[model samples]
Target: MHGRQQPAGHRFRRSLTAAAAAGALLLTAAPALAGDGGGRGGGAGGGWVDRQLSRMSLEEKVGQLFVTYAYGETADTTDPDDVARNRQWLGVDNGREAVEEYHLGGVVYFAWSDNLREPRQVAGLSNGLQEAALDGDGARVPLLISTDQEHGVVSRLGPPATQFPGNMALGASGRAADARKAARIAGRELRAVGVNQNYAPVADVNVNPANPVIGVRSFSGDPHLAAELTAAQVEGYQSGRAGVAATAKHFPGHGDTDVDSHTDLPVIHHTLEEWREIDAPPFREAVRADVGAIMTAHIQFPELDPTGAPATLSEPIMTGLLREELGYDGVVVTDSLSMAGVRETYPDAEVPVRALRAGVDLLLMPPDLPTAYDAVLDAVTTGELTEERIDRSVRRVLELKHDQGIVARPFADVDEVAERVGPPRHLTAAQRISDRTTTLVKNDDGLLPLADDGGSVLVTGWGASTTARLAERIDARAGSATAHWAGGDPTPEAVDRAVAAAEGHDAVVVTTSGAATAPGQARLVRALLATGKPVVTVAVGRPYDIAHYPQATTHLATYSYGAVALESATRVLFGEVAPRGTLPVMIPTADDPGEPLYPFGHGLGYRR
Candidate 1:
C-alpha cells in the first residue's frame, strides 16, 4: 500500500511535476478511483478495497473509523508545548508515535496545536505523518489529513496560503463564481502542503445576526443564496488535479442560534417545515454537488427529532434526515466530540459510539482519544455495534481517501510548496474577490472618493493591526494619515484622543466590529461625527454595526478584517473600485427594533 521512500527533495519534485502535468486533464476528467472499481470500491491504491477490508482485523477496522488529532510539526519533536499537547491528547509524545500506536485513520491540523508552521515545513510534516499511517504499525492505509482552512476568520493555514474575505464577504458579492474561484485557489494551495481535506464552505444560513459562531463564516442569511454558493464552492474546492476534498459543514444548520456549541448546546425551535425552508437548502445543494463530506452540527432540532438528541447523536436527524431523505452517500462526520453541545448530554466514553450510531462516519477531536477509541472497540465487542457496521464506515473513509487521490499521491512536494502556495496569481484572485465584496451601504454626504487634496486623514479602529493597515493603505493611495487603535468598547480616554485628533484631519474614518453590542464604539462614532469633520464609517467586522451609529452619513461594509478585505475597503473608499456589493443580511435599527436601518440587498454605488 505504501510507496518506496525517496529523498524528500527528489520525491517532491517528481510528484509535483506529475501533478502539474495532469492538472488540466483532471479538471474535466472524473475523479480517479484507486482501482478498477472507478466509483468508491477501490483498494489501497490499485487493488480491491473489499480484499483489503477482508484482511483487516477488528482492531484495525476500528482504527479506520476514527480520525484523531495530534500536536507537533513532526512525528518526533522536542518542543515542550508540542510534547505536552500530543501527550495530553493522544497519549503519545509526537504525532508519528500517535499514528503508530492508535493506527489513526486521519489527523486534523490546527495553528494553535503547532501542526501548521510554513509551507515547506508543513509539507514535511504531512509527508512524515503519511509515512507513519501507511508504513507504521497501524492501519497501513493513507491517512486523510484535514483542517479548517475556511479562510477569513476560521483559517488555520496562514500567509503564503491565499487569504479569502470569508463566506459573508462572498455573500455580499452575490456572485457564485467568486465563491468557486476562491475555493479552487484555496484547494490547490492546501493540496500543495499535502492536506487533503478542507472542513469548509460553511453551509449554515446565518439568519440570526447575533449568531456568535457562524456569523461571518456563513455565506448569507438567505437559504437560496447560501445554497448556490455552497454548491459552487464544493465544485471549486474539488476541481483541480491537486484538489483537496471539501466538506460542507454544520448540517441541519447552526445559523439561527445565538449560542456557541463549544460553550453550550443550542436548541433550534424550527418546525420540520421551517427547517427544510430555512436551513436545509445549503446541505441539499452540497450533496447534489457530490461534496466529500457533510459535518453534523451539535445543535438540537426538536421538531426534527422529539427525542431531544443533538444532530451529532440523533439517528432521526443524521440517518433518517441526512442519510435517508437527503440520499447523501458521502462520509458523515461529527463536529468536535469535545464540544459542550455534544458532550454535556453524554459521558465522554459514550460520545463517539453515539455519534457512530447516529450515522457519523468520522469522530473529530474527541477530548480523549484513548477513551473514545476504547469505547468504540468495547461497543463492537459487546455487540452494541456490529463489525459489519464498523466496516461500512471504514469503507466510506477509504473511499474518500481514494477519491481525493490521497491513496496514490499522499506526499506533498517540499520544493514545490513555496511555488504553489500563495503565488501572485492566487493573491490577485483573492484581492479581486475581496474588491467585489465591498458594500457601500450609505453615503448620504457623498463623502467618499476622498478629494486628492493631499489632506491628512484620521483612521481609527478597534483592531490595532486593522487600523494600521487601513491607515497605511490610505496613506499610499491618497493622503497623509494617522492611525489610532481604539480598542473594542473604547474607553473614554481613547474616544477623547481620537476625537481631539480628528481636528488635525480633513476627514475621520471609523471602523467598528460588533459595534451593536459595544456602546463605546457608538460613542466614539458619535463624538467623531460631532467633530464636524466628514465621517466615513467602515464596518470592517459586521455590517450590522451600521445601525449602532445611524447618525453617520457614510458607511461601508467589507464583512471581514482580513488584509485583502481592508485593502478592498480602502479601494472602495477612494473609488478605485465602484462598490457593487449589497446587503446579504438586513441591518436593524438600534433605536427601534421593528424598523431596518438598511434592508437586505440595499447598497449604494458611486456615480459614474
Candidate 2:
C-alpha cells in the first residue's frame, strides 16, 4: 500500500550494470573507514552518544526526529507519476538539497524513488545522499534510509533481486522456520542495496474476510499462528548475518477491518480483552524477541483510546500501551503520515507536533516537511513541546543508527550488492517455498493430476501474460496447450470471444484474480463453465477467488502471482510437483457466515 506505481521518466545519471558495479565497489573500498567503520561514532567510554547529543543545537536536534520522503522522481520533476493531485505530495525534489536544506534525519524510498534497474543504482543513490547528510557541520549522524520492501506485491526493490513468496504463502506452508529464512534472505538482499530498515513481516491477524488491504499480507486468521510466524520473521530479518533492522507493523493490528486506512480511517470496536486475545499477541511476541522497530497504524481503536484517535497519534496506545505495558523500547515509526487516513484530517502544519505530543518517536513522511518542521519548532518556542521531549526522541533515533552501525559504514559496495542480491541458493529456496505453497482446494472427478497424454489444452482469462505463461509451463511438462485472455473484469464481447475460442480444447485452465470483490471475474469463470470442459481454475491472488465459481473441476490458490509461485503452480498442474500447501485462510462461497466452504488447514495432494 505504500507505493502505487513507478515513475517511468528516465534519470540523466549513468546507467549502472553488474560490470560497472564491480569497479564501483573497488573504488569505494579505499574509503571504507570514513564511509562505514573507520571513525568512532562513540568512543570506548560508551558515553559517546551522550557526548554527541551534548554538542547538538536545538534546530539540529529537533531535525533528528523527522524523516521525510525523497521520491527521486527524475533529477528534476514535480511529480513523474503524472497524477494531478500528487503534485503536492512530492517532497525533496533533490535528495542532496533535502539533506542540506532541512537537516533531516532519514528518507523513505518508493518505487518511483528507486526506479532502479539494478542494485548498483540504489547503492549510488544511497551513498550520494549520505555524503550530503554528512556534509560539513551537517547532522554528522548518517541518514536512516528506509523502504517498504515487504516482498510479495509490495516490493520496492525486487526486480534484479530475489522475489520470495509473501507471509500468507509461508503461513500456508505451516513452517515458522521457513518464514524466518524468507525474511533472512530479504534482509540480506536489502542490506546489500544499502537499505537498513525494512517495514515488513506484517504482524496482523486477518480475521475479517472483507479486509481489502491485508488479505495475503497477514500470516493467518488465528492469533497463535500469526504470533509464531511474526516472531520468527522478526528474528530472521534482524539476524546479525542479515544486519538490517526489521519493523513489525500496523500496531495493534490492521486485520478484521473493512476499510483501508490508506484512504480513510477504520474503526476497531473490539474490547481491551479482545485486543489482548486476538490482536496483541504477535506484537507482544515480536517485542519479546527484541524486534528492531514497531510501526503504528492509522486505524482507530475505540476501546484502546476513547478519544477516537489513531494509534499513530494516541498517547494511550503508543506510549501507555506499547511502551509501558508491553515494555517495547525500540523505535516506533508511523505508517506513512502522508496516507489519506491521517492527512485528510490534519491537513495543516500541526500534525507533526500533535504526533510528538502523543509520544511518537519518528514521524515518517510528514505531509509537508517544511510546514511540519516549523510547526514543531513553534511548539517548542511556545512551551507546548519541551526540549527534553525532543532530546529523548533525538537520542533514541541516534542510538538506533549507532546500533545499526550506520554512523560508520553508511555506504554499500555495488559489487557485493550485485553478487549477493539474488544468489543461486536463494532462488532455489524461493522455488522450493513456491512449490510447497501450491494449495489445491478441490479436485472434482479426481482431476488431481492432468493426463500426461492429454490433447490440446485451453488456458485463458485474467490477461494474456498470465494464461500464456501457465500454458507454456504446463505444455513444457505435459502436452501442447493454447491460451485465451480476458484481461480481468471482461466486457461482454471479451466473454463471448472466450466462449467461441474454447471449441476444440480437451481441458480448460482458467486463472482469475479479484474473484472476491469483482463479480465480473466470477461471471467470466461461469461463462467458461458453460463450455462443459474440465475447467481447472486457479485463484492467483486471494484464497477467496474460488468462492464465486465453485462449479470448476479444480480450485487452487497460490496467494500471489510472483514468478516463482506461478511457476510452482504450473508444476503442480501437471503433477511435476505435488501440491503441499494448506489454506492460510478460509474461503466463503455461500451467503451465510456460519462456516467457510474450505476451512483453514485444509488442502489436498496427489499421491501419484
Candidate 3:
C-alpha cells in the first residue's frame, strides 16, 4: 500500500514443480548473481533475480521477507534437548523441520536460544540450516544468518570470540580508525561462523544522560563524532574480505529517550528541523557509506508523522523520509516484532502486514511466525497488499543475498572456523582498543600509577566476574590484590565488608556500573573515601557516575565492564598504559544540572 505499485502481472507466479528442480542445481549451476545495486530491477543481478522471481510461488516470495529466530545447533539434530527447544519455540522437531514448515527465508542466532555455542558448532549449524532452506520443499534460497555480535555487553558467542569495549569506548578514544579495526575484526569472526549479517554499529547519538538502553552502546553524545565513527564502522564491517552485511540500527535515533522500547513504545518529541540537526547525521553518513541495511526504531516522532505511529509502521518515516528524501535504496528492516514497542498498536498478525505496507523489507522475529506469515499471504490474497508489492521486497532481499555472496557460498568450513575466529592477533587488537578507551577523567589527587611497588590493592565492583577479573589483572602487575563483588546497589553489610577490606589494602579501586541511578554504589565510594587511603573510582559502565561522585577526586571511565576493558583499566592504573581516552559524554555536575564535572573531551595522560 505504501510503495510504488507495479502492474499486477509484471511477473506471473509459476508453480513450484520446475522451480524445485532448478533449486536442486542452484548451488552448482545457477548463475552467479553477485554484485551491487540492490534496488528495484536489481542492479547487476537484475536478470538473474527477474528469472528467479518468475518461477516462485506467492507463498515462497512472502517467506523471503521474514528473518525469524530458532533454537538449535543443527537443523536435523536428534538430541532430545535440541528437539524440545525447537518444539517449544517453533513447533517443530528441529531447525530443518522449522525451515520446511514455515518456508523461512532466514534465521537469527542468539546464545540463549542455543543457536551459538562455539565457532565450529555455529558453522555446522549454519550449514545445516542452509541445507534445509535450499531443499526442494523449502524456500530454496540461501538463508541470511544473522546475529548481534556487538561485542561489549551484547556479545552472544563468548570466549573464543575476540572481545572489545563497545562503541562508546571507540567514541571516547576519538579515533575512527579504532572503530574501523574493531568492526573489521568482528566482521571477520562473524563471517567465519557463517553469519552473513551483523545487526550492529548502533548509530544512535546519546545526547541524554539518563538514557537506559542505548547508553554505552551509542558511539558518542556529539553528532559529528558519532557520524564519523558510524561511517567508519560500516566500511569496516562490509570490507571486501569480511563481506558481512552491516546494519545501521534504530533509525531516526533511539538516543534521547529515557524509556526502553523493549518494554513499551517510546515517543521522541523532536521536530523535523531538530531531527535533521541531531539524529539524522549518523544515518545520513551510514547511507553515504553504502551501508547494507538500515533498521527502523520502534519509537514515534509525532512531528514526522502526525498520525502518531512508530517508525516501524509509519510510511512517512520509512518510505517518504528514508527512501525518497534520503535516497537509500538498500534494505530496510524492522526492529524485532516480538518487542512490546511495535505490538502495542496492532495485533500479533497485523504487525508484519503493517510493517510491510509501511515499506519494511524484512520483518525480524515476529512473535508467531505462522500467524504473521499467513497474515501476510492473506493480505496479498485479499488485495490488501498486491503481489507486485511483495515482489519489490523479495527482489531487494535476493539482491542483497547475491551482493553479499551468501547465495553463491553460504557455508563455512567447520575446520577453518577455529583458525579464523578469536586468534591471538585479533585478541591483541581488541586489547589495544580497550587500552585506548580507558579515560582518566579526574586525577587531581595524583594517587594513580601507585609506584608499582608490590603494594596491595583492593578491586571491588558490581558483577562477581568483572571484579574477580580486575583483581587478577591488578595482582599480576601490583604486589597483591583483594576482590569483593559488592552486588549492584550493595547492601550496608556488603559496603561495610568492602570498606573494612579496603583498610588492609594500600589503595582501593571501586568500579561502579550505572552509578548515576544506583545510589548504593555512590554510598560505597563515599564510605571508601572516608577510610583516608587513596580511593580511585572507576566507572566501568556509564561515564555519568562521575556526576554522582563529585567528591571522589581520582576517577576513571572505562565505558565497559568487558574483560578486555577491565584489563586495560588495570594497565592504566599501574602506568602500563596511558589513559588516552577523552570523555565522549559530558558528566554533568552533581550540584548544578547544567554544569559539567568533566566536560566533553576531558582526560589525563600518565606523563610517563
lDDT of 1 by residue, 1-608 (tens): 11112211111111223333343223223232111112234435435466667778888887877777777877677789889877877888998888888778888998877888898888999999999888944357888899999988898999978899899999888899999999999999999998999998899988777788898898887788889999999999999679999999999899888899999999876656566667888999999999999998999876676667888887767776777668776788888888899988889999999888777788888888899999999999998888777877888888888878888899999999888999999999899989989998878887877776788999996889999999999999766998989888998998998888888888888999999778899999999988888989999886889888889899999999999999999998888898888887767687764365676677888887
Q: Looking at model 1, report the run of 10 residues with the lowest lDDT sum.
A: 1-10
lDDT of each: 0.83, 0.75, 0.82
Residues forming the 10-long window of minimal summed lDDT in candidate 3 = 1-10
lDDT string for model 2 (1-608, tens) is: 01111111100122334543443233323221101111223434237568778888888887788787665542232444533323445443476667766777887777765435468777777777778877787557788888888877688886678897688888788788888888888888888877888898899988777888898898877777789999999898888844778889889799878999999999876656567667888999999987778898998876677667777877767766677668777677888888877776565586777777766778888777778888888999999888887877776677777777677678778778868888899898888877888898888678868878857788888856878888888787666788788867878788888777788778888888886666777787798888777788888877877767877768888888788888988888878888889887666554743356777778888865
Greater-TM-score candidate between 2 and 3: 3
lDDT order, best first, reads 1, 3, 2
Q: Which residue ranges in model 1 land beyond 4 Å of their true spot?
A: 1-47, 591-594
* Lowest summed lDDT window (length 10), candidate 2: 1-10
Question: Backbone clashes in each candidate structure, one number apiece?
Answer: 0, 3, 0
Residue 476 of model 1, lDDT score: 93
Instruction: List model 3 lDDT by residue over 1-608, tens digit each.
Output: 01112211111122234433333233223232211224644577777778778888898898888888777677688888878867776788888887778777789999887888888899999999988888785447888899887777788878788988899999888889999999988998998989999998899988778889899899887777889999999999999856699999888799878999999999876656566667888999999998888999999876677677888988777776677657787888989999998999989999998888777899999988888999999999998888888887888888888888887888887888888999999999999888889898878878887678889999996778888999999898889998999989988998999988888999898989987778889899989999998989998888998788779989989999988999899898888888888888766776664465666677888765
TM-score of each: 0.92, 0.88, 0.92
